[model samples]
Target: MSLSRQTTSRRRFLQGTAAAGAAAFVAPAANRAFALQSPNERPVFATIGLRNQGWGITNKSFKFADFAALADVDSNVLGANVEKAAAKQKKKPDAYKDYREILDRKDIDAVMIATPDHWHTKISVEAMYAGKDVYCEKPLTLTIAEGKLIEKVVKETGRVFQVGTMQRTESGQRFLQAIALVKAGRIGTVKKVTCGIGGMVASPVIPVAEVPKEIDWDFWLGPAPKVDYRALPEMRQGYGGGVPLYSNCHYSFRNWHEYSGGKLTDWGAHHVDIACWALGASDTGPSKITPLEYSLPVEYKDGNPVVHDQYNTATSFKIRVDMPNDVEMIINSAGDNGILFEGTEGRFFVNRGKIVGAPVEALKENPLPEGAIEEVYGGPVSENHTANFIDAMKSRKQPISDVWSHNRMLEICHLSNIAMRLDRELKWDPAKREIVGDDQANSFLSREDRKGYEINM
Candidate 1:
């Protein structure tokens, strides 16, 4: 045989041997199973933020998924959840302090983002880029600009996304009933809506506290301006840890503008969402926002708070918005914590617990058309919010609380915050998505994110 022909045959034999060796190295049961995973296999999930709402999703979502990983900046919380997941499912999952580590894994099929409001947009954008469906807790964005970033990424990556607004999937369907009634014209026309989300209470200047040993304080700060950790007891573990802290860190992060839009974003994320749906204004937003009256914990000038510390959001306030179709909305810090729809024909109040009023009352005699609530739910009733997300992932369809509509509802809340802070009425160009005329108000549409943590447009 010629020397050239013999050399070519030797090279082919070595290449085949190397390939066989590589296959042999991937023999671990986990790695082998991952390679053999079927396309129809139940999605394996990793959760990024796990405190109040994070744990709430954890408890309920286990049935529909194989919880393969958990990530948290808090070591104590991460370890506890890892143990809890093992006990609950008899399957111990991996744990990581940096969520990006979880995202880089090829085995994770989706992610649940329950981080503080400021972190949602960044994590979600990256998660979809990593080819994972996402279930992000609301309010879906910290600002209008973040919402735009998310919407763009969602379109670019056709991943199924669900906002953690479960009112649309409630068991008794009270919110659904209310929305159906309002949309069905039972109230004649939704002329105005009153959302009583209650007022914010400012925390006094919090003394700088020692950072918890278990937490990565810097990572916890994320995109927010650098500040000392104000140690807080994790709040509201039961009700998705509703407002975990009152002093403004950890669970109480909602009370500060640097992190959240106060109660405007907290409760408004839920109530305003339903109100938008009922009015058929989910895709658009209010044309104008007027702050009738409000008080901040500190002074303000030029659309920013005068005081840098303490709880900086509005302490108590009433904000009014004029949406399309000449419909009006009054958001209040007073009265029962629920949403009221008043139309020319009738009125009714509905909350998480029940739906009550003349419209709902008349339902006994003049019942809604059958399957009406289900239609509002996007098909059959989902077991819960997470279930709806999983179902959407399976069908390649949008979930009940989709990103576009949630952002629109959040735009109302964010605009309300802007007006309250500036202590005046502001007009909005919905198509342009800018605060009309007032350059300062328009500036509030997005925030100057901290370096390295910036969310790209």
Candidate 2:
């Protein structure tokens, strides 16, 4: 649908459903069929990067978006996902090895970006400048400077952007309830928040191998430094299996510092974002980041890994972050994989599975005020992360996981990795968004893209 027509239809649907507010609170996903009304009113979408998460986000959004195109560097993966997506949506979408084709199509109202961490900023910025909304995966940018660039482009284009932090809107609304509890003073004067994001395992030296004929290796390595493709013969066996067990590509990209920030950005992106939101520090950031304990997979000198054949990110780590209001935030690879919030009056533990504590139990008798979750969410929460993105696209407003707030919290995760690599404590000036008096550490905030692939502003 055209942007103007989509907006008019959305407004009318929302007005007609105003009486269903009570039902919406019970099952927001059902009430969120506002975009499912007529064929001409449905929004158009296309997906970039058709790997595991690329397909995951696209599959869930099939109910709300009519996908028109799909792009990926791997021809095999691209072909497979296009068939699956077409079957689900009952329409065939054009396939392309290059994502720019999708961005150039004026009919595409928005683009869902699930590219590896390294490629996020380039594609997102270009898509916005091309006049399309964006729904990019979390750990929004590869570096702090990249995040700033994305935020700038979003403001300049006035496009709706959403990060794939579903915990804020989905997960049975467990995370939303947790935030509402904190706002209700159920956890009075929050003292500390712990985020156990888990860790990665060390990989043996992976031998350099010939690039797959079916994949465009150069395009896949866009912006990242040129390197020989490395892989192991033993194929990975489970959920994210079929790809090389230890390669500088596929799912293993998260284990490399060159492409991703290890577990710190992998899972920390989700948990730390929630921790910051509950503490009312989403707009600000930590004052200090200290790597209390860490174990790297390989030797390092001057913050750069000595070897390149194996994974180089930290295998295990425990970081301390000093937040506002004297809140001591701990991010570690131990304990439960969730956020544990403690306060002076009471405490609570929340993860994807459940939310439990004395305060959560007390909710049976002394419940929180009506519309508490909505207030914490800034407005009525949508069905899921993508639904929220579409809702924002219609209203021409920022989604719940806006770029400004996401970058603020993500700086903590990025700083944690920096502190671990340097093996020391680093002071931060949040307002300035820089490391205090440490030029070397500050240098890691941004990286130059490879020649011929720089972002086309």
| Cα lDDT computed for each candidate against the true fold | 0.79, 0.87
lDDT of 1 by residue, 177-230 (tens): 888898788999778899999986677566667776888988887898898766
Question: How well does candidate 1 match the true structure in TM-score terms?
Answer: 0.88
Candidate 2 TM-score, true structure as reference: 0.94
Q: What is the lDDT for 157 in model 2? A: 78
141-202: candidate 2 lDDT, tens digit per residue: 88999999998998887888999988787777788899888878888989999999998899
lDDT of 2 at 265: 92
lDDT, candidate 1, equals 0.79
Candidate 1 residue runs with Cα over 4 Å from true position = 1-40, 231-246
Backbone clashes, candidate 1: 3
Q: Any idea how many clashes model 2 has?
A: 0
